[model samples]
Target: ADGYDSGGSDEREFADAWLMRAHGHNAVDLDEIDAAEDALQETQFLLDDFAGLIDDFESQGGSARDLFEIVRQVVNNKKTEAGETN
Candidate 1:
């Protein structure tokens, strides 16, 4: 592409940083790499749904904070179901 660095080093660095932050380390086995890829894919799927919901809600004049509160409540309810406190 006809972009910034021309060598794409910047894009590689950004991807490396993102992957490191997501998986916590660069030294991992093949299985771990597979697991991380699976987890990331699943998270992307969830984020697509979450983003859609946020867009729909905002389109209706709803506050993003309200969506966050709903997520918090869901987390708390799950914890309660699992006998977790606080």
Candidate 2:
């Protein structure tokens, strides 16, 4: 119901049609969006921590590319689960 008139079409019929279309597709949920944002933020924090670890590994003369790749994949998976695209 919140997004029912989001289209803001000047034509009444078009606005009504937009509302119908929103209902047909299920309107966006604000709570879900907030949850997704929270998840993404968490993923970012994880990435930051991994970045620090990678830097430490590299400083110790360890090849960190592989470790970085693994971390990248895990972070990507977390983002995907959060409904985000890289």
Candidate 3:
């Protein structure tokens, strides 16, 4: 979903709805907003790391590339799973 072959669609939709409702009521919760922003920032950093790992793998041609991708996918999948439960 969300342009990625990976998961997390349900989590994304729920969060978006929560934010919209909070904004509509003019009662935004700073803690929740901060937590969401933090999660996004953390995920972005993980993605940046993945990009760097890919570049390094391309240049070095090592065996770890597959392992790295697998790890990334697993982490992302977990995030999607957690999001769905919320």
On lDDT, the leading prediction is 1
Residue lDDT tens for model 2, 1-86: 77645444467778678798878678778999999999999999999998898899989898887876887999999999999986
TM-scores for candidates 1 onward, in order: 0.47, 0.45, 0.43
lDDT of 3 by residue, 1-86 (tens): 46744257897788779898878687768999999999999999999998888788777876675867888888889989888532
Q: Which of candidates 2 and 3 is the stronger one according to TM-score?
A: 2
Best-fitting candidate, scored by TM-score:
1
Q: Give model 1's TM-score versus the native structure.
A: 0.47
lDDT-wise, the better of 2 and 3 is 2
Clashes of 1: 0
| lDDT, candidates in the order shown | 0.89, 0.85, 0.82
Q: In model 2, where do residues sit more than 4 Å from their true spots?
A: 1-26, 66-86
Return the candidate ranking by lDDT, descending: 1, 2, 3
lDDT of model number 2: 0.85
Distance from true position, residue 81, model 3, in Å?
19
Question: Candidate 1 on 2-86: residue-level lDDT in tens?
Answer: 5544358897898878888988664558998899999999999999999998999999999999889998999999999999999
For candidate 2, give the lDDT of residue 6.
47
